[model samples]
Target: AIDTVKSSAATWTEPAQSTTAAATASVDAAASSATDFMENANAAETAAASEAEASALSIGDYITAGKTRSQIQGYGGYTDIGGTILTIESITDQTITFSIVQYSDSGYAADTVSAKQITAQWVKNTAAFEFCDDTLDGKGYGTLSYENGTIHIETRSNTNHPTKLVLNEDLVGT
Candidate 1:
């Protein structure tokens, strides 16, 4: 009778040991899958934050005060000039006040010009270009887009002609 009892106990314990090992393996696999999911989620979050930062703009990105120079050329009957000095006098929540200094040439003194104000929406960047459609004094209101080292300005308030202007970054500060 004692021998029979010992054999029975051994058979029962063998299956129990196998069941415990299978359960442990299943738990380990679940833990690994969960870790992988968490890692992927973290990577996605980081990419979104980076994209937002890239699209955001600051005041300095538009133009520096007393530090940017714009070469003005007119087309389609608009008044033409050699160059103009650009300075941001004040930037408000909805508008930007500009102090323009016009110059005929290097041999001439800067012309006394009136300050210009334009809506802030015109200076903000959209996609690959920075553009605006706000009024800019006697020159008439138009939509202008700036990209690379060039500006494409179309005067709507004028004769609705497009003008192309090249930016001279070298003369920005001078």
Candidate 2:
């Protein structure tokens, strides 16, 4: 009778031990899977953060004040009017404000003088081009041209003129 009782106990204990071992393995597997998922999520977040920083604009990217006429022409425009960047104020993620002067020759064949307040906005499809929809005198819009290192700001025409203001990075602060 004693031997039979001992044998019964041994059988019961062995099954319980096997069940405990299986449960432990299952728990370990679940924990490892959860850890892997967390690691992957962290990696994705880090990559996204890096991409945003890369897209941020810098001050130098907007405009360089006081560029000479010859230097401006190198970027592909005629320096018919000599101008220097007077000031750069209020820079944002999408806009910048600056001042420029040009020697105009429309009045007397000699270079006439003019100053313009330039507001530039970031355009998505066009990089480095900011459309100036306003003028120094609070005009709603103006004819802005950037060609041959010269930027021309003229009165905004209402005659459905195709002379839209196109901004180029090369024309900024020149």
Candidate 3:
């Protein structure tokens, strides 16, 4: 009877040890999975923030109160250098309108020059805007970049002439 009891007890102890080891393995696997999920989620969030920072300017942001208008002088081109004013008229969700106010820099009140309205739309995949109006006369497009309320704009002609404009934080009336 004693021999039979000892054998039965040994059999039970072996199965019990195996069960404990299996439970430990399951717990380790679950912990590893949780850590992987957390790491993946964090990486995804960081990527989203980076994309947002690189996003193009929104027209609505330029049309808000106390941020309505900006005036920039042109540079880098013989026709536009020191003789032009790029006046920001208004910005819509799909379009931006501005006027190229020209002046005769020859120190004479000679002739009357009209302001030309140039309208443009945002270009796909380039993060820039393209002028489709008659005012450009086959010149190229414009691109805008903003940071901390300061805006930088560049208009490039087809001949590779680039006119740069910088807008500071002071608000101007339309």
Candidate 4:
């Protein structure tokens, strides 16, 4: 009778040991999976920050401003009516105003035309607006003014020669 009792107790102990081993293995696998997920998330955040910094431009990017005709004469001489140089004085989100100086034989001349004599046109990304001269023989110069989200052009002919256009914005148009 004592031997039968001892055999039954041994059978119960074996089953309990097997169950405990399985539970411990399951816990270890769950911890490993959580660690891998955290590493992948950190890598993605770093890449996004780098891309945003590269896309923006500063005021110094306006280096194209104030280039003289003598400097650019190698590329193309400023002989015709379209040889005007643009100098970006100030720029903002809504407006950009610059000084327009034409390469004259005498030097740089003021573009003075009545507001009514100038015609305004709008283009895409290259130039926001263009001011053209309104005349029969096309012998007037125009000045461009960007203010309050609108462009104003003043066109006038040289007092000495009407045939010679002074500040021709058509030369600068792309």
**lDDT of predicted model 2:** 0.45
What digit string (tens of lDDT, one per residue) describes model 1 on residues 52-112?
6554332332332232234242223334334544454455444554433334433233322
lDDT of 1: 0.43
Which stretches of candidate 2 lie above 4 Å from their native place? 60-90, 97-119, 123-174
Q: Which stretches of candidate 4 lie over 4 Å from their true place?
A: 1-6, 53-174
Tell me the number of clashing residue pairs for each predicted model. Answer: 1, 5, 0, 1
Model 2 error, position 42 (Å): 2.5
Error of 1 at 137 (Å): 12
Local lDDT at 26 for model 4? 74
Q: Note the residue pairs that clash in candidate 4.
A: 82-171
- Candidate 3 lDDT over 1-174, as tens digits, reads 999999999999999999999999899989999999999999999998877755534333232123212212222333422233345666666666665433343323332132345666734322365543232334456665455443445555555532322222222222
Query: Over all chains combined, what TM-score does candidate 2 have?
Result: 0.41
lDDT of every predicted structure (CA atoms): 0.43, 0.45, 0.48, 0.42
Better of 3 and 4 by lDDT: 3
TM-score of each: 0.41, 0.41, 0.34, 0.29
State the displacement of the C-alpha of residue 104, model 1, in Å, after optimal TM-score superposition.
14
lDDT of 2 by residue, 94-173 (tens): 66554433323232323322234566663431213222323222222433333433333443323443222222223343
CA error at residue 102 for candidate 3, angstroms: 17
